[model samples]
Target: MGASDTAVAMSTKDSSEASLGATAAGPTPAAGTAALAIAQARVSQTDLTGLTLSGRYLVTRKVGQGGMGAVYEATHTLIGKRVAVKVLLEKYAQREAIVKRLKQEAQLASSIGNEHIIDITDFGNTDDGRTFVVMEFLEGESLAECLARETKLAEQRILRVGAQVASALAAAHAKGVVHRDIKPENVFLLKRKDQDFVKVVDFGISKSLRQSSEEEEAVRLTQTGMVLGTPLYMSPEQARGDEDLDHRVDVYALGIIMYEAASGRVPFSGANYLSVISQVLNEEPKPLRDIRPELSEEFEAIVAKAIAKNRNDRYASATEMLDDLNAVIEDPTHSTERAKITGPRRLLPKAPKIPRIAWAIGGAGIAVAAVTIIVALLMGSKAKKQLKNANANPPAARADAGVATVAPPDAGEMVPAVETIKLTIVTDPPGADIFREEELVGKSPQTVEFVKNNKEVNVTAQLPGMEGTTSINPLERKDGAEVKIRLKKLKGPPKVIIKKTGETGPQKQQGGTTSHTGGELGTNPFAGSGTVH
Candidate 1:
């Protein structure tokens, strides 16, 4: 339960995306095998056949039963939506004891509006006095199930799951809740028709600071001696039964889960649950990169931080952890710098012996050296030209006009030829991005210098998770008529709501047509291929 064994299967699973309501039947362990022992032992005698609730949610069948409760797949009468409802067995619901706690679980989980966290819409008791919690019907497999099919995922996919779970944890943590049980089984990876969604489940053992510590509430509903969480994912404090554990426990668990997802192995394992707990407390698991050397150092670092033994060493909140994961995904190189240089900086050659302006200011000694270097370059050019001139003419009658003359060099030469048209990248919160002619460029605050004069200049700036602004105009300035652009960050995609005069839309575009794609706004239609200064 704490450390997953199914992760070994993730690597070999089919790559094609599954569809909504799709269920892949994985191989099941023999009933008496060690792997299936705990699951089999927990099977309940409670019969849910023909049980109906609210005259609508029809109990289909028992999906699984565990130490906490029994889960069932049911159908909603009106919407015909399939949902899973967890019901407390008769033993736990003897006196409406578990009913109140399950209600609290629903309330606490409902407060968390994050999509990654499971949605609990209704909670009630049946005519037979059994308490039940109705949650969204998940069509996808649990992380454990997926891991069982394939232990390790590609780096990109792992990052996607990590980012999503982090967001779920963040939402839960912000509401003063801690999901004491954070493991692969509790993290469901649901696939819609076109995309996958992450939903965290099983908050039955969750800790909420908002709940009162009265005598009734002080006594936990779970039976004593029944270890609440999977041992491998439990933090040291949690394993020690420390009542003061906070969100840090979840941090440690998230790290363990991510580590396993990447390497298909847990950081720590033992012959039995007790030994595993002992090792978790006394030993540090080997680094993930040790198992998969190809793993990014930055990713390893993030896992290390999340699994830090000391709570203080872990990220302060789930959002912080999520941000780190997103950063790692967005820029894999951020984790480490290689001996080789990359990006635009690599274009330059070895450094010059003296700076460019050295000839102007250096003393006579260095000046002579610089002059010699320049003269050598000139001599080489002269030789080439002389060869051409000799070929063109038999002998140069000492020419009165030695060389062709051209107009003075353009001012554009003094500046970088890559001068991008100046356009302010306005954001709701200002940010930087490169854009041209209402199209995305690669840099911000850029200048297009190398281009010839009178060329059309389209400049734009783009910021991630925000709207981008672009301007298209000819860059035929005489001296310096500054093109002042004011870009505003749009709250949503650029919308075209024709307001009489002062009605505001998500985008405040001064000019150009508007359209939306993927929750983003774009002004101006796509332009034909042409160079923009």
Candidate 2:
């Protein structure tokens, strides 16, 4: 399929049929409607029921479909065991690039020997020249469906799912594999021994960070300017179409998914592909406490690190992230005094005008620079006070001991304070709460003072009955400009607009296969929320 819809989903209608043995059959689709339902998907739909593949597994029914292929539920004709089969579209069979990509998806997935990774047991060409890969059939819903059905999961459930995902990524990274497309839908969850068990699926666009000498030239499917993976969850590097990518992309995506799980919305969302990408590269997601103040500082800090704009600022590896996540799970009150190690327990502000010193200089430089600037200003107060005293008592006043003298200026006045500029933040409604750079500064219609720190900051206006909006300001400009934002009053039911990027012809080409349904995903509800078959 396309990059956006390159995923598979489990059977939604019936799971009991799985109990049937080899000789048994599942419910058959109503007579003529079979073709219509498949066709409605906008693919070269075909009812593959009753067809046997590789002379071993029998295709029972079509389970799901994607950009370049269709997934079918099948059974082992001889052993009676069930499996999921992904078949390349007949038209794409002749294209070497498409064929190689599908084959590689299977090979790379099979290489990672993690219990949480879906098991790929068979891959080969069919009698008609089409390719197929058979995998273990899962029995539960995708994380996408689970979220739709239950908008938010309990904290414990989230922790369990998160831990398993991190564990799986660690194994994948250790094998030099990067699941370039990690999102809620790519994460499959079902019950295992009375507890939630996770099985990460869809490795269609994954890359091998560590490739063998012989396979190097043949495996570069992504061209110089091509951008793969869903725009909503791709890392900043991936969004920019950068050539060099590694495991950190998955780490970044995992944080996005976790943030969505906790807040019921993504940090960045918009009307189309370009809009969402712009936010991802330039905007910071809302803070967890802003939406759910009950969240622990540890959680906020952990997620902040995962999605940091600079890859070096994120956790060095999935293993490192899991360590902190597991701690928060054990005891929410645990002091995540890890700021000493990760720099601070919060998201770094926007990139500064001066280039971020290379990590080659280490984060310690940043910490020292930040600490040095403040200390340099306040530490000289003693000398400034001594000079003031010398100026106040002119040797003449000391000479004439009886002379009245003016009172010495207060100590606070002795030290020259950092220059400050006042920014009057006002919303149309006038009563909304304002947050400047993720911190609750004050209510709208209020004037807040900002130091001339030469850094960029974004201010937001939000209220219960009104829609929120954010504006970015160059707080360093030293101009005390007033920021005014307008809030829309909520009238009735909030509208849910699912913007499709397909109709925009120019963007599709510029986006380079932004989504897989071949832009034919006309009514797929999960269009922008990550591929769910």
Candidate 3:
């Protein structure tokens, strides 16, 4: 019999003896003895120190405890290898649904032979009906701890970490497993062989997408209308409790994680869980560029596509997203066309109106000039005819109309005036250096007049720590155009550099023991336990 079974038998025997002693005494004494027996049984169920499991694992001490189960640091008796043993709490061991889910977590994780995923070695129940799973012990802190210490991650580090995670997710998705609960707390950073390696843990809420005739009924742990993911990173479809979910939900969650890593904040947040879910369902995240402008446009585009509201719009698979990330890592300048955002409407300055008097005066002047030119032409023609006739008949002189003839000035001298328009450039945090066509123009918030041209103009804005450049197309109206550039502050060097610990071998150490009660499941069903068995 298993350890749990033996403990149950012992508890039964103790309760029987207490009942007999109470029967020999009064009814009040019998009730008191029965209460004491129940308390003792509860304590015995949790006290598994120095106990042996399956004749292989020897429990030394408890490492972690949570709502679902408690994790213990154990050693294999024969091999003397350290391992982590996760036992389902006795209170929840009786729940068929919870037990099935825990078993599924062990079975599914063990099947995937991925280096980035936690490895499960064995899983079974104790003699006393307490289920447990044994996995390879790891010495490292979770990504959650790292994020808490370092508010944000470096760009290169984020990409490297994201790529590794995507690769793991790709493996899982290929095998028909969708990790429904993916968060920082579930990602572990282990120091292995002088290198930082990522290990994705906690597949307790993961769903197997493969449909088999025998497992159809067994895969119904998550019923319709039941939500099962973290609200902060939950996708819209998941938040809505959609029954038909796939690997894209994991993609969305990864995008959220990446967003936080880059900006030190999640796109959507609220005072409560419901409010956060509501925001995820109805609100659109603020553009990433607004938070970190120095990030390449291509990188932002990749993230935007991953977190698209519609699953169809997101990357079809994790591999596709990984490819884009690889491209960005190779060349930061690479960019892809994305949907444009028409920002909030601004109240533009009203255009100055041309007075009617000016128009009337201009019109009168044009008419007078036209008349003078016409009269001059008539006189010139008359003089030309007279000269022609005189030249023909040199001997005959006409003295009735004596007039000196003059030729009109050269037509080339009358040139049309060039038209010029005003171009204005403004920066978000004003006083940035402005450049036009490689020529250094004055500082921003300045206006200059240039001859109107049909070609597009390229303008660049630069400051000590912020910079932005854009092309302004030719304006169709004579009022010209005003261009506003929003400059992004450049990201400084990383505050912390995560290095692999030099300790190559694992130390024989154990965690503190803490008794956990109740059967309530939090956001992370298996919070303390790395993986549920």
Q: Estimate each model's TM-score.
A: 0.55, 0.56, 0.59
Candidate 2, 16-92: lDDT as tens digits: 23334212654344423443433433332344566677778888989998878888999998999999999888878
| Candidate 1 stretches greater than 4 Å from native | 1-45, 95-100, 193-195, 215-221, 225-227, 331-365, 368-533
Best by lDDT: 3
- The CA lDDT at 491 in model 1 is 79
- lDDT by residue (tens digit), candidate 3, 1-533: 66555666776776787777767875566567567767766676686677788889989998889878999999999999999999998888887777877888899888888998999999988767889999988899887888899988877677777877888899999899999888998888888666558988888888888856356345455555457888898999999978788999998898888889888899889999899999887666765666887875555656766786667546789987777677556443445533232111112433322111111234444564345445644676575455435434544324443322222334554333434444445565667776654555566654434444576666667788777676654343222223556677768732221223552221111111111111111001001111111
Error of 2 at 446 (Å): 31
C-alpha lDDT of residue 441 in model 3: 55
Q: Quick one: RMSD of model 1?
A: 22.0
Off by over 4 Å in 3: 1-15, 26-41, 212-225, 330-533
lDDT by residue for model 1 (1-533), tens = 11121231221132122211133544323322433433432232265544567677877887888865888999887889888898887777875545666776798799989999899999887655678899987877899989989989887678778889989999999998888899999999987655457899877678786666772354354555645677879888887777677898998899999989998988878899889888777566665665888976567667766786656546777887777677656444455632221101111222223213222232443554445446544676475355335334534333453422222224343233233221212222233544444333333223222132355555544455444433444444311112223345567765231333543322222222122211111111101112222
What ranking of all candidate models by TM-score puts the best one first? 3, 2, 1
